[model samples]
Target chain A: MSSIHEITLMLNGDPVEAAVAAHTLLVDFLRDSHALRGVKRSCDMQVCGACTVLVDGRPVSSCTMLAVDADGASVVTIEGLGGPDGLDPVQEAFLEHGALQCGFCTPGFILATKALLATNPSPSREEIVHHLSGNICRCTGYQKIIEAVESLAR
Target chain B: MLPRPFTYHRPTSLDEAVTLMARHVDDVSPYAGGTELLLAMKMHFADYEHLVDLKRISELRAVKRNGGTLSIGALATHAAIAADAAIQGSLPALAGLCGSIANARVRAAGTIGGNLCFAEPRADPPVLLAALDAQLCLISARGERHVAASQFITGALETVRAPDEILLRIDIPLTARSTRYERVVHGHRTVAGAAAVIAQDAHAAPRVWLGCVATHPVALPNAEAHVAANPGVLDNALTQAIASDIARLDIADDEDASADYRRHLATTVAIRAITATVEQEERA
Candidate 1:
């Protein structure tokens, strides 16, 4: 019985393997081991959505979750979204709407919006607000972000 | 902040999880979702040398209805419970409440068992579960026993669950009762909350419970007695009954809300819950 757990999972689109300590957080593992700096770490508590990432297609606060928890799951971060040629549609929508200011909270907002749209292709304005309420954005005053996400709604 | 190093064990079965808990005693915690436990661990508020990961146990994730009971697996996440078809069809009020808890990320990762077991004073589920007369099933190396939801939480961040016990599931008996849960929330924390469960028959006893205003959820026996006697009446007498019951609760003034304000909100939410329950009954 060892505290060091060998975990293998799909990171973004690639299959990756790592032997992480039992106490290692998923956010630390993502940003430190894989260098996915896009996954911001503001407010280690789950209250702030800065550390949100998708595990098995559902958004979870990576900061509160253990790296080993993502072992058999497919995890998607902001770095996993766009293609080499162009940005993802969500990114394009955010860019078009000018949904960012300092852009520190942009990655988290974009990823949360992607998750929202993936499950519900057509979401009401209220639904979008309710879904993204966990992800805080102090820069854009949230109006532009809502409008940006609204533009992508079906 | 990082939690101290610990041994993580992912047990595939209930017996194995029980054995692990029994082996480690106070040094272990059954990790489910980890939305609350991990945060506490990182903050150095709690420490455990061993964590028995309960995610792999398939039996603990089942949400099903058998005969007259709705058995909700303890490990069922808030998001999963909100989206569960059976919950939506049978207990839509509970489903709606689950959807509104915390935010998208917390809902996705927070488990009902973890929420109830954590026994956070501001949590939402315990009140509703108690009002609905839910039975909590706990298993250990010794055997299985059921505790009424109302008696589960002893104090804030405390429960009667032993070190070797694991919460298996929540059993809610399906009855002809219309339930409504109402709350006032400041940010993610519930300020004051109430649950009203009114039976279809006017003669049957109605259940009302208030939470987030005290150390633990408590039954408003006086108010419930009034409701049970009057049946759908929300007059001055009912209001007085509610006020008397609220006066008995040991509420504290906190940064989230003042003691006076919480009492006001508690009374308001309780009236709203009962009114909504009555309205629901009328519609049905």
Candidate 2:
């Protein structure tokens, strides 16, 4: 029988308690269990960064991570990045730079940018491209995404 | 897609984790980061009845330097290694290689030990680690043993690690060297990875290692001999020697590239790595 794990995580700023199957993915736990539609599931494989989320402030592919792995750790999805008063600075930068086309890859890009800016606020264009290599966008071709991240870097 | 259902075991200590793995034996897998193993499980390529998660064991999450050797915990994330002060100060080439892995998320989620244990030929760590002459510490209920990096990986997706053993850490000799890693990738996966390490001492012989194009990391002895024989020189004869050197290896065939193309790439990549390392050494 599959074991049922009772896990507690700091989701965003709040504590969330869940009883999940040991194999439940962090992406599924957030989308199906918590209704956070912002975490998209594009490539179930670990390649695509659409399922990216920050566990304890480290960006990881939620599709590749077990929900139980984050037990007792802090997880921040795109929805959690928004402030009570307004959108996150990364979201604002994306908007100002028109960084979205289909909008499917925006959350992942935003979260990745948030992680990048958090650690390196003034990354060069090459550094930005290197850091964002995990994310893929068919519509934008990443020009505006680069601009968005570059603007934030400035 | 969700991975196949399995009982999860989160052991807070390495001893307990080893005991659990030993009890389950062939039916169990030591889960760390879950990037590669989970992918195989989800794709139905491999499966396990029990997964022993080792994240809670904090002892294996450190980077320490004692004497002439530097020890990096098995659980150290690629991103952690890339940003680690010790690694950056001692082996910037390795730090750069770690930074240039699959992507940001993978770097954040993947562990050095997990990478070596998985023994993915296309992965980046093993080749450079092998060139650096790193050693992996394997521990279990039967005590512990340290295996040289070159011997740790036996083949593609295979290692010398026993079912009951858990890789504890990776230790690298702490000596300054002119090192460079070169790789070509398509989409999200690597096509080829090659590395060159020249000891800081001008007369110290250099070593070359290549990956992804082979079932295991291939060290080129003829190429190293060529470089050592002709210091501060790169020419057609050197290229010919490198080509002949890697031609002896048994390269692998994947959908991305054929064995022939990989062999060709091996020559170019090895030359590129050696040339870059030599230039950097001269500049330094």
Candidate 3:
């Protein structure tokens, strides 16, 4: 095998560079290298959406993407969604509707909703369910989350 | 956990990527959206010394229409396909499948080519592509070639793509046939164990592709022929034939489901999908 390489890309609205092992996952790079621990890693497999982030404005499971594959691409983590002063609409809706319980899966779900609503501001109930089906939440049942998103549509 | 150490190269062009793959042979693997490839690497199921990242290749990200057919770039993410109104209009089934794939987050990053090339029996797009007779464009250091979806998958986690080849695009022929998809999942608790059926009724023999019941997506020729020969007798003969055939397939083992259960689900889902397709055609 060859040695690890250094790569640079726009991350969370900032141009960042990091030297990582060729096999390093984007999730690890965000959490460890760049210290953007806002993107949590749950299952680490593509099955769970806890590691969801936007790659060029599209929500993608960061755990399934290689750090090198993200080179030259624009990425947005949960931190980029909002800051200490305020929150994105989806985040606010999540909080207002009590869509989270453990909050482990909140970031992934919020990002997924953000991506969905960006293109579809008025998604039907079925559309909301289908869109968020990939992000599994073990707590607080998806009813409240769906309610929150539905409320947002209103 | 992170994947084993390896060298990564981002090729700016398809030609460069193919050349890198040709030079490295089996030691090199292509990384598209890396949804499946990266996960496989993390699980230690693939041990390649070098990864040729195709993200930098601009040509592979296009979603264009050539004449009546829709040519979706291999690198086009599921989100892109779902959001494209052209795909939604020309291939509604394809768009619906893209929208329903895994989740919004995964779909945002996962590519259609990656899904098909992964050769997972349960993957969504392959079944729909096979039923629609989608053409896969392959490129390599040598040249380009086109293969039908049914001919692309050789077996479980396997494909006809050579070591030096990259799947360039998926060309879906524009047709007036109405299509429908039915997926039977045990309620989304686990990742595996889902049966999907895609069918088109306008052709002489309505095409049906069954997923999650075999090593690769299976085209139900017997059921299709049964429907074509006796369109009136579809309910009984088609269902029986598909059920028996699915019962006999050798599906890969997974934690989410057993071989027998997947077979049963496949037959059940195929019946529903076939009926739904017929009803949809009637409504149209």
Candidate 4:
């Protein structure tokens, strides 16, 4: 096996470095090495958006990204989407709209919504559906999730 | 599933990146966002011994517009393209296509060059680029070359991109013609496939490109020629030939969809796309 490589990046407002295998996924590095388990690993593929995170203020599936590729980039996990003390409006909207059942896909959904609403403050309903089309949630059937994003748009 | 172990090299300069790729050749995989490549690697679909990370190469991340053409750096993400005012003003079809790609997360990380270079049959950009007649610029230690979008892709998951070459920029020429895109995505199921139709009424004939059809993006030349030749007979003949050609096309069908259904969807989407393009042109 190839030797591990050291990568440095800004993680949720903190500068962190880790020696990860060249092929180590960003989600695994976050969950295991950095201990920021808020970014869940579900399908471990790009199909399911459970592992989404913000790379330079844009949401991306971390499972589909290598840790070393994130060098000098800024990443924001679900934990970075504000906390119990002060929640982001998107997260609050998700809560208000009951967007989660088991909550396995909540983090990805919240972060994806954050990225969307950031660029488009008041997107139409069709725009919401189009923007969130890539994310799959078996538990919620996507109605509440759409509602959550819609509520935020309003 | 994790990707196979490989050495990582993050080059800050495009020249250095090109040199690294030229040196490594087939062993090095140049990754932009890794949205598709990393997933394919995890699925064991691809194996490379080295990865030349292009995210650190700042030169490849710019989007500039000159007189008559827009030069978009290969590393510019889909989100960047979709939000770019120049793209929105000049090529609204491209902007709409960018916004309509997978989703926000995928758009954020996915680069236009990466998506085009990956050459996935279901990707949205190839069909739009083909209709737009976009030019793909490739660079390597040897030299640089430009290939039209239609010639860039040879087959499914295949491109003319040499192993030693790096995609530099995509040049889109400005034309007076209007363009539009329409796609029918099966939204009920998890793996429901999509059929996208791109049409541009530029010169005499309206060029149409169909996605999710054949191994690569398929151009409807016969239909386009018919429309161009007989500008007055715009209704049944054009639709019939195009639909028939689409039905006879040989495309891969997995368990999620059937060849017949894809053909039907392709014809329907193509017709809709053409109708939309014509309607927009008439209004303009």
Which candidate ranks first by lDDT, i.e. highest? 1
Regions of model 3 farther than 4 Å from truth: A1-3, B187-203, B251-254
Candidate 4: misplaced stretches above 4 Å?
A: A83-86, A150-154, B187-205
Provide the lDDT at A114 for model 3: 82
Task: Show where candidate 2 strays beyond 4 Å.
Answer: B200-204
Candidate 1 residue pairs in backbone clash: none
Error (Å) of candidate 1 at residue A27 is 1.0
Query: For model 4, how does the per-residue alpha-carbon lDDT over B1-284 read when each residue is reduced to its tens digit?
Result: 98888888878898899889988996878888888898888888988887888888888989888998889999999988998999999888788778767767777889999998988877778887887788999999999999999799999899999998899999988763667777765542212122222234345446777876677777787777765676435588878978776766776676656877777777777777777765666776
Model 1 bad stretches (over 4 Å): none
Better of 2 and 4 by TM-score: 2
For each candidate, what TM-score against the reference? 0.98, 0.96, 0.90, 0.91
**What is the alpha-carbon lDDT of model 1 when measured against the actual structure?**
0.91
Deviation (Å) of A44 in candidate 1: 1.2
Q: What is the lDDT of residue B201 in candidate 4?
A: 34
Give a tens-digit lDDT track for model 2, residues B65-124.
888888999999899999999889888988988888888898888899999999987888
Native-to-model Cα distance after best TM-score fit, residue B213 in candidate 3, in Å:
0.4
Model 4, C-alpha of B275: deviation from truth (Å): 1.3
Going through the candidates in order, their DockQ values are: 0.73, 0.83, 0.69, 0.66
